[model samples]
Target: MCHMTACSLLSYIAIAWLKMVPMQTIRSRVQFMKISTLSLIFCASVVSGNVSLKYLPVSFNQAIGATTPFFTAVFAYLMTQKREAWLTYVTLIPVVTGVVIASGGEPSFHLFGFIMCVAATAARALKSVLQGILLSSEGEKLNSMNLLLYMAPIAVVFLLPATLIMEENVVGITMALAREDTRIVWLLLFNSSLAYFVNLTNFLVTKHTSALTLQVLGNAKGAVAVVISILIFRNPVSVTGMLGYSLTVIGVILYSEAKKRSR
Candidate 1:
């Protein structure tokens, strides 16, 4: 996480130095507040999602995450009072129901993990909703890259203190481990660079489309990941699970067509 933040901070500096995005783009306090809030939500969601993996099967985690569209729609309506087409809401039912069906046999579920996963999913939805609303205003609009630059530093500020408090001998352990596995440093660097792109693309999508749309897209991505895992890892997938995933894909397609026709 530290590596991720450091990479973003360094990238932000480089971009600013190159005058690719003006430094003044993030000067407003209102903009800072919005970015900072998003940073906190993003950081917390990531941490909780990671921690949940210890107690819940990956299937369960994915299932819960598949509910993001539901929360996104709810929050979007609550915050903006913007009602989507009735078919849009109807489509989310199968999207969510299929995921639950896919993970119905998960045996490693725990209460804490379930709570954390739900929290993480809800936080992700809330972050998307808030980002869409906050950035939509003419006065608050910022280039997605510029917003990421500002958000990364604030997230670092919020996460650093928590890391210091929670992780014992973090620096000492990291140094000792790195000495035993020299590849650790390179792996961390690669992970950090990847993390930057994830954040950058997330912001870009939200900037270009509604948060609810992003959530729907995320479900499709999850389905693709499941297929890739099954193919590459030769993992066993139950017929029920396959059926559920098929339903989800079908729902996504129907939803997209519904949206297009509405437009």
Candidate 2:
């Protein structure tokens, strides 16, 4: 939580320094309450994702994450009444089925972790949908940088209290860790700086394409993560699990093609 809060604060500072947005004009352009609500959803997504990694192996966690497009499609329809081509809908079947298969084959399956990952994925999908719906109007619309400018500070405010309440003496713990190894502090700072660009690109992608499309892209990212994590962690993998993951990736590829043809 501390790391995440730091990332939010860092992003806020960077955006302000870059002068990407006019600080005084934000109020005239959009309602603070609306942006604040979206920031809450952003906090939930970040927290749930971080928590799930504690209980689940990266490979398994990312395998489940491959189903994000399925959730995104559902949320996009519910929030925006947007419909995709029938072929696009059909491609989701394998995307969903593969995850079910992978879950059955997973060696270190934690029910609680699974639930958390699902929540994280759903919250992420919801964030994208709500951002589009809430900010689509001409008057309310914000470019990716401006959206991050507003959201970062609001997310920091939302996270600080929760971090303090949930993680006892977080500052003390971090200080102790930093004293033990100065390298940890540098690593954290590097990670937080990277998060700014990640959030910027995420907002940019969602702005340009549909939310469901972003999830389809994320499926490919998860596939890459699966391979990289297995190599780094030496995590055991089963043939069934590999088969299921393969199916999921294939499904995502088909989904992208279907969407392109529809366009």
Candidate 3:
């Protein structure tokens, strides 16, 4: 694998290791089941979304995909009945708005592609809520690692069925990727690793920072993913879209710094 893919993969492994301790203490039935349940939903989305993007335009995909944190805050508000820091909601609005503005151009309305990205955001949002909730739970004696022990295998299981069933050219794609685009193989691996890191970071930062911080970072991840994709794949962009992205990044930074200062 190349440096980018390898670095991404290593980040995930290190993050996973960080979760080992907290997960070890997870003994309660409810916590275990909750962990399993969240892993399945979120990881399934990550896999499906990744697969969809292989067929879909990267710009369109990332644009829709960026709204994840909005869903996250909504889920957090609903599930826990917890009041979010006002700045969290403020950061979220521009994040979703920027994504919508960015997605306005082309890519013939393939509803299938759109649905997958929506599912991705939904899954991510709910998973964030679950992570926030789990972090709030203690006395189980484990660290965030405890959650990953159950989550990792569950995530693998979650991805397997959808991948086999949904991906039409799974066999062809696999072979072609193996021979022609060996890098696609590395990309898939790195992508999955990033998904896992997303989870681990959600747990870690949720503890040290506010749910707002995690949500903001999640939005940033989408931005970073989009920028990286544009750089690597040369995804098409317009003046308006680029302007929106710039504003979105600036807004997110301001929002984060404002919240951080408040804290």
Candidate 4:
């Protein structure tokens, strides 16, 4: 997480220096506070997602992640009172039902891991919705890049204490690992860079479209991840599990069409 945030800060700075994005500073203490609060949500989403992957098969984890759209819709309504078309709402039924069905068929389901994955998905959805609501005003609003520029550092600050308390001697462990395998350093760099791009694209997507739309699109990404992980890891999957995943993908398609029509 620290590496990712460091990469984010440096990349944003370079982008700003290159004149690709305006280097806009936070306008006031209130704006800083707003971004700080959102950073906490971002941290929670990233941390929980990473932690869940420790105990859950990647395929099963992605399967649970497909539920983000349902949580996004709920959070969007609660936070912004924004309503979507009736058809759009209807489409989310299969999106949610598929996860419950998949869970029943999962071969190695861990209760704690399942809860963490759900928390991660919900946190992601909540962060997106809150970003739209909290930063909607002209004065408060920031471009995606600029928002991340401010957010990345604040998130690192928020995570530092948690890291110290939760994990002992992380720095020493990382140093020892790096000494043993030089490839570890490169791998960390590659992973952190990829994470940086993922976050950048996420913010850009939310900026151009609605938050719910971003999460709807994320459903497809999750499905693709499920397939790739299954292929690479050869994770044992039941017929019911595949069917449930398929149902979720179908629901995402329907939701996309419903959104297009409404638009």
lDDT of each: 0.74, 0.79, 0.66, 0.82
**Predicted candidate 2 versus true structure: per-residue lDDT over 1-263, tens digit per residue:** 44555556755665677664454336563467777888888889878988998988898888777777788799988877899999999999998888888888888778998899989988887887877766675667766666666777778788888889999999999999999999989998888877776776676687778755775677678889999999999878888888888888898888888887888
Query: Sort by TM-score, best first: what order?
Result: 4, 2, 1, 3
Error of 2 at 103 (Å): 0.4
TM-score of each: 0.84, 0.88, 0.71, 0.92
lDDT of 1 by residue, 2-97 (tens): 655765776676577766556546657767787888989988888888888787756556667777767888999999997879988898888777
**Cα RMSD for predicted model 1:** 3.2
**Strongest candidate by TM-score:** 4
Candidate 1: regions farther than 4 A off: 18-22, 201-217, 229-237
Ranking of predictions according to lDDT: 4, 2, 1, 3
Evaluation by lDDT, superior candidate among 3 and 4: 4
- lDDT per residue (tens digit) for residues 1-263 in model 3: 12223333444455456433422445678877887887777565766687668666676676666666567667877898876687767876786677666556443336677777788878877886787677676664344555555566666565556567876778787887789878887887777566556556777797887777775776677677777887888867787777666656665666666566666
Which scores higher on lDDT, 1 or 4?
4
Residue pairs with colliding backbones in model 2 are none
